[model samples]
Target: MSEERVGFFTDTSVCIGCKACEVACKEWNAIPEDGLSLTAMSYDNTQALGASTWRHVAFIEQPRPEGRTELPLAQGESTAQETPVGGDGELRWLMSSDVCKHCTHAACLDVCPTGSLFRTEFGTVVVQEDICNGCGYCVPACPYGVIEQRPHDGRAFKCTMCYDRLGAGREPACAKACPTESIQFGPLDELRERAALRVDQLHEAGVTDARLYGHDPDDGVGGDGAFFLLLDRPEVYGLPPDPVVTTRDLPAMWQHAGTAALSLLGGLAACFALTGRGRR
Candidate 1:
């Protein structure tokens, strides 16, 4: 029997802009260094998830919400007042750790001719580096742009949801290292329930903009193994608002192509038969 599906539910509201998850992921996975040079744009050094960086913490500075004087505490258990607002419209920082969505209808798996990407018993998508043929098809097949081809070797890579750790009955390194429990990992069902409650709490606390993303099983990508709770629009955090599996239309496309090919062949055969009859 297959194991229960497991995944991550990241709450952006409680994220403190720390990159502990990123560091733990790199140390546990032995990912190569992406870059060390500071971008000077923000505290975000890695900038985004890539072949070398499995977990990325984004730092977004925006104007503080109007009439909001206190920041909601983690889990909405309490509120913290005296939030420091900077000059020029009183900015508030939005921090979120981004990773692969691990879509239920994974387009990367569909486009991977080499069978590099596969779904685990836990219903999480993983990539076998040895099996990857460097075809680069899966790179563009991903809707969220999570997967990337390494420039040095041209092999695609993305988050595996810590498949090895799951097999060993341990939580992922990132979740274990998260200080604020922003990155929660568990059975998909339980996580969904907990996320719903958390959203409700935030809404009751007057954070009306709190919302869930990638949690619906009926979504365009059939929901995601890794979902998020965001404080603002998905686009504000560099995520697509509505992501559909790229290969969703493949079956119909292939059927149409087959019909057109058969029609052309039949017409040519009729033309040849009429010519032969005329010659006779």
Candidate 2:
């Protein structure tokens, strides 16, 4: 019997800029503290995800649309806010938790010399640290730049989607600790349906910018195991506008190289035969 494919559906609209998911992820995974210094770029302390930081919460402060006095609250509710106006306009915060996509066509898996990165029974990707061998081939191969090597050891690390917890039939700590239920986890198919419905709800409530990312199976990386519902452009959240698997053309390149090698060998053989006949 096979396990059903499970993944995360992160709804960024409802995220309150809380770092509970980040804290829960670190505690559950026993990940080391990467840093404590503030980057001075908003309220974000851990600027981005890295080897030691498996989860990162991004805080983007942008100018709100003019005359938009009310903001849509979670679960399709709207509330008027007495927000302060910046020099440009009224500032609104966009918060999102960033993690590994666990791509269906994982480029890290394709480039890893060792069998360190693998797909789990639940259809998520995981890296076995003990087997990594510090090769670092997977670092640049990742399209999302999710995988990273520890500075001291060079072994690659990234989100495993809590493989151990999944085996124990529990949700990931990030999702469990999300107070707003922004990070929902369940069967991939179910999550997709739920996300679509959420998008429709937001749209009907006048949030026209609501959209889904990495949800389509026909996407360039064959979709992501973990997807997101965003209220703005993906780039605003520091996500790539278009992501393709880094190793998508490897098979074709190898086939062309083989053909060239065969052609060269045939030419060499013919020359040798002519030389032999001439000698005779």
RMSD of each candidate relative to the true structure: 1.9, 2.3
Which lDDT tens digits does candidate 1 get at residues 101-164?
Answer: 9899999999999889999998999999999989999988999999998998899888988889
- Per-model TM-score, in order, reads 0.95, 0.93
Mind giving the per-residue lDDT tens digits that candidate 2 earns over 154-177?
888899999999999999999999
Model 2 spans with C-alpha error above 4 angstroms: 67-87
Clashes of each: 0, 0
Whole-model lDDT values for every prediction: 0.90, 0.88
lDDT of 2: 0.88
